[model samples]
Target: MELQQLFLEAIQNGTMEGFFKLISYFQTQSEPAYCGLASLSMVLNALSIDPGRKWKGPWRWFDESMLDCCEPLEKVKAKGISFGKVVCLAQCAGAKVEAFRSNLSTIDDFRKHVMACTASDDCHLISSYHRGLFKQTGSGHFSPIGGYHAEKDMALILDVARFKYPPHWVPLPLLWEAMNTIDEATGLHRGFVLVSKLHRAPALLYTLSCKHESWVSISKHLMDDLPVLLSSENVKDIKDVLSTLLSNLPPNFAEFIKWVAEVRRQEENGQKLSEEEKGRLAIKVRYLKKFSKLKGKKKA
Candidate 1:
């Protein structure tokens, strides 16, 4: 909806906290197809997420250029990013993301999410929708939902493409209809993403890998088989249990053991480690010793 046509008075009574927070960080797309990048950059800065690297000479900020970790800039420039790619980029930048495609979601469900995001100052929403439904001049576009007029049921879209259009209010049902359309690039329905700050945890020495081809079986072995094998009276020696365990693990498991040994050597050489790191290393060392014992049993 056009700015003149929208009831601006209703927005004051509705949720305006998110709108106020986002307005200061609002940015225009650098390139014609940089709507996703610009929208994400605005949300990231509004949430006070540090980019951890300098954008210009001395300033560390989130810009369209800084958001190329997930998809290369050249590719995103040639063809605009997909809904899933936006989610990936947001997550890589340490923002918590909850994405929903119109195809996989109901209008009622979308309304609830829209209301929740607009109600809080801690989160913001970015909608990916086709412009045809809005009678606009583009295909798929990305824009942040600054606020929602509850009584009017209209959402304020802070359009990143400032040259083409101004920030306007769109009706909830009409916006949902626009998002329900498919993007030719992804062959999936356009959608919206709720972006918020990720609550970080203390760094760990090691993390589980699910990228392995046999990850499903590996996880099952760790969860079910390993416990039973450890407690089994039929297991005569620890070597037998170790053998059973090692056989289930991927071949790259040895590489992890090698890495653990390297860390131990570093510690022996007077390298300082965090208490959490040291504690985790100790557990791995104990497991390594068991494997060593199993190897010695095999040699005998």
Candidate 2:
């Protein structure tokens, strides 16, 4: 279906709510293999997710260049991104994503997902399908589903490769067939991804670092050892538990001490903090005081 046909359907049925939001952010792929990046950037902008960095001339925006956390831009430029990489990139951008490959999902399920996405402005769907199945000029392609014409059972594809093809509607089942084909590069079927905003927790004054190398041991101790020590009836004094925990602390445990001091400084400066932040600070301060008492006892 061409733009004129899509316009006709939109005017008749009033089902272009998703399309209206997406058109404002629609972009053409900068490189031949940048379909995934372009499609993702459009959906990210449509969903109003802040890129957390400046795009150009002080504008913070999502672009093909900004999506390089999962794979290098150079590699993506050489060979287009796979479905899994697209999901990773979306997650790295802080968007909540759910991906479905045609081989792993039924066409009935895909149609239901398409209906749900096209019927609302809160979420958008990005389709990854082979163009050859649709008798198009390319192999694999990525595009956002702008709308679903239920009466006709066709889906409007906002193709990112605008230079080659205009926005068109294809039968939903045929689209599923296109996606069901295996990609020669990854030996896996293409798929669709549902993109939406990820609601984040309130800002915190202190947080644990999962990226640290010692985090594995630290997390294990917190999850496994701490419970047993707390519940053991033989452990008479809480100070004994603190001493054992302090002895097992990694060398970088001083980082937590620094955070405790920083929180105190912020409080002294009259900076208002969330209750969650205050609670975390109190816990850290109490742990530090216990460690301090244990150290004093050992020294004396």
Highest TM-score scorer: 2
lDDT of 1 by residue, 240-263 (tens): 776776655544454445544335
Give the number of the best model, judged by lDDT: 2
Superposed on all Cα atoms, model 1 deviates from the true structure by an RMSD in Å of 7.8
Give each model's whole-structure lDDT. 0.80, 0.81
Estimate the TM-score of every prediction. 0.68, 0.70
In candidate 2, clashing pairs total: 0
Cα distance off (Å), candidate 1, residue 149:
0.7
Q: What tens digits encode model 2's per-residue C-alpha lDDT throughout 250-296?
A: 55555444444335445445346778777876776777678767656
Over 4 Å off in model 1, which ranges?
Answer: 1-11, 204-300
Model 2 TM-score, all chains together = 0.70
